[model samples]
Target: MPYRHTIGSRTYRFDDLKTLLARASPLRSGDVLAGVAAATYEERVAAQFALAEVPLRAFLNEALVPYEEDEVTRLIIDMHDATAFASVSHFTVGQLRDWLLSEAADAEALQALAPGLTPEMVAAVSKLMRNQELIGVARRCEVVTRFRNTLGLRGRLATRLQPNHPTDDPRGIAASLVDGLLYGSGDAVIGINPATDNPKAVSNLLHMLDAVREQYAIPTQTCVLCHVTTALQLIEQKTPVDLTFQSIAGTEAANASFGISLSVLQEAWEATLALNRGTVGQDVMYFETGQGSALSANAHHGLDQQTCEARAYAVARRFRPLLVNSVVGFIGPEYLYDGKQIIRAALEDHFCGKVLGLPMGVDVCYTNHAEADQDDMDTLLTLLGVAGCNFIMGIPGADDIMLNYQSTSFHDALYVRQVLGLRPAPEFEAWLQQQGIFDEHGLLPASTSSQLLKQLPPALR
Candidate 1:
């Protein structure tokens, strides 16, 4: 049947189920909707069964053939809402078509038409489709899952234990936090530092990876991108840079030059993969731009949300066909410096959803406090949840400090967890104590204590 395929606000038409399934099957499962399709047909069916509480296997056996399109659409919608097909892999376009055709062709004559089509058999076929979907979804999911696994409630709490005072060892600080948050969690930690205008800084950042690996006791990788001339110098030196590019945010090279725009970011990323040459190391890269709301305000020109998103898409489109890795991330949503309302609106309006599309990661800079009122926090968080933000950065402190001292940063993180429903780490309480955030006397800081009282569950203020 002819149908329209929709991803967010964009839509495309397919001539038939075969055409639709083929296009949809391989379109990277970057968002929740695609993630569902990444699961096996049997698993998808099982998910539906779990939700609908109907014997899907029996229904398939009886209604495989001659099922109405409306009925199928309803079933698919129900399954989409109820199941977390994030990890499933096996279902495919061909399998879905075959299953539907098989079911619809002969309902009551199940035994005679396809006597061997047992639940296990169906599940196996679906698994094949899911595997294909995983080829696309895995990278996107990896980027988000890494952050989620690392920053469980316990991880957030533990950040307080570190010396609040700034240190010369930013990488060390990041590594330590990763180690604590992801302890007993076995995943690679990759860091990309774009903090220098010198090519040598890229080499310096690479050397720092060793420190992060040794200190954290986990595998690690780092990449550095120097501005245009510096990047060209590094390439001449054969420094094995992961990504080298023209700085798109403030330079004349990026202006009026598509080659220096997001396209260059993609080229640099592609170059990084070539440098790897099939090694088993993670690919890490970063793009440098100006600081504060300047980027957001002039995204297309100066690095605002729209321009950042466009660049990200360009990079994703280029790399997706090659590596299928999740090492790319966008930096600098400097909340402490940017206006609160502007940052919040940008995040909700475009950034989160845009990142999801490219299947990459976002690293928003945040203050060490919360500055907004409880009501505002609630509204912001609710909006973020709807926008599908996977990672957030900010200070770990009481609600009041976050609101008053660092309102933008504070509300951003709180909303990330409280409103968005991202799960906290299992050992979050211990981490909280180490930070001196919560005391034995139950004498919480007044700002935090007051907000806590206001947000208490109906039964236990």
Candidate 2:
């Protein structure tokens, strides 16, 4: 239990370094690694090399826990290795998409010729790709799934109904859920991240969503995106919890910022399981992560934000979350500056999260002050549609009043389905057809569709 490790080619004495990387979930060494993020580009590159050491340790020790084998080591090296981007850089996006569409094209050919190419590498290349080209490759990829588990993300892109309000009132929250479900967005889960940590507020939100889901007979999971301990307490109170929600990070300090430890997360998972409220097998945990989380907690060790994001997924795997998303642009311009940077980061997170074996979704959002617009999100959404993203957030009118950001709207969900020939979860689609919710053309019925809205508690009306 000493604060030292003689890892590959270097000796790390916890007393000697400044990053909490040694004390985090992925590392979780007894010593708290703390340091300022590297200030210069050269310092950052060095930091990336240093960050790779722990993952390399995890990879070699076969103690990556839930992850038997992941692409973290290769991805970390690929991120720093500029040569990985060279072979694919020559062709225009149009040329690349065409080749992928052609029968002679092989995905491996890019790697075979260039060496060290990975999906994350392609995601980086996506920075230069026009939206159409990025989407084209996604549509042709076979890994996209249409219907799996309680949620359907691939065959039809799914959306979470994030109806967060300032008061956590039943009427306001109910109104948002009605808006999303009527717009065809409850395929993922009606998850809410509370503005306050009050257990009563969270309990009211969960029970309220349960009432709404039952009324419409919508076959989807529901969650209150509070801390693990809050959720555990709700479960202790015998409240219905379909999925346990938590926000996680790559480093121990970042997780500590959220007041969660690996043991706390495991306890939450076990307690939720004992309740047996999930309809989606055993994968009942819901987790949210963003690229800037580590840096925000002052825990990043000068590593690239995307690599830190992937390390968070290592925490996610421990609980087998039913839903996992990189809140993408929601972290704003600091970690990823502007729309172009945000777009590339979104794709990179999705690619890396999927490769790490987690169900991946992007928040596709931005704050008012960030240099991003709806068009940028539309582009990311289109590309994610093809990449086979698992689920996306569906806020009322693409805005979160409580969180103060612009996210995808329910109409956006309908837009992706219409443009891409996608469908919802099989059972949910069956239910939709049963209720005539969407026609063969995937269009909602005319008017505000008061039928579903009328089902809300009468006091709201």
Model 1: runs farther than 4 Å from truth?
Answer: 1-195, 214-225, 228-263, 277-312, 319-340, 348-356, 360-382, 394-461
Error of 2 at 87 (Å): 23
Error of 2 at 386 (Å): 1.7
lDDT of 2: 0.63
Candidate with the greatest TM-score versus the true structure: 2
Name the TM-score of candidate 1.
0.38
lDDT of 2 by residue, 345-389 (tens): 677677555544567778988887788899988987877887777
Q: Give the Å error, residue 278, model 1.
A: 8.3
Task: Evaluate candidate 2 by giving its C-alpha RMSD to the native, one decimal.
Answer: 9.6
Which of the numbered candidates is closest to the native, going by highest lDDT?
A: 2
